[model samples]
Target: MSNNTNKILTALAAGIAIGGILGILFAPDKGENTRKKIADNSKKLSDSILDTVKEGKNKISGLKHNLRDRAESLKESVEEFAS
Candidate 1:
């Protein structure tokens, strides 16, 4: 996704998560329980997001390497044909 789209989605997610947490805190549930739930959910969300970003970076790196190899091979073939 584009940087702008990522920023928008991130803002939306933060808004939603914060709103949900506020709702839970104001509900009849115990404060400690509500806080624990929020903490756990936030941790899980962060971990999942981090993992996704790492995977994307790895994929991009692999593509770069493959493209570079292909370019080099093409260069060699052209040089051979020129000789």
Candidate 2:
């Protein structure tokens, strides 16, 4: 993974955690309710991160294929021109 991607992911996680904690703190609720909310938010954050990772993997794979194709095409052209 790139440095920028790492930074973005880290920032996103921090933001979500801070926002969730603040929201919970301000809301008038029982301890059990607060815990449940925290659990639910954690699960959602986990799922979101997984989805983002999968998407980045897919995009990288696509770029790899695209670059490979271009390289192969250039090689073929060079061979044809030399012959």
Could you tally the backbone clashes for each prediction? 0, 0
lDDT of each: 0.81, 0.90
RMSD of each: 3.0, 1.3
TM-score of each prediction: 0.72, 0.88
User: Looking at candidate 1, what is the lDDT of residue 25?
Assistant: 77
- Give lDDT tens digits, candidate 2, residues 6-78: 8998898889888988898789999899988988888888889889988988999999999999999999999
What digit string (tens of lDDT, one per residue) describes model 1 on residues 14-49? 887788678777878777888888898888767776
Best by TM-score: 2
Candidate 1: segments with Cα more than 4 A from true spot: 1-28
In model 2, which regions exceed 4 Å deviation?
A: none
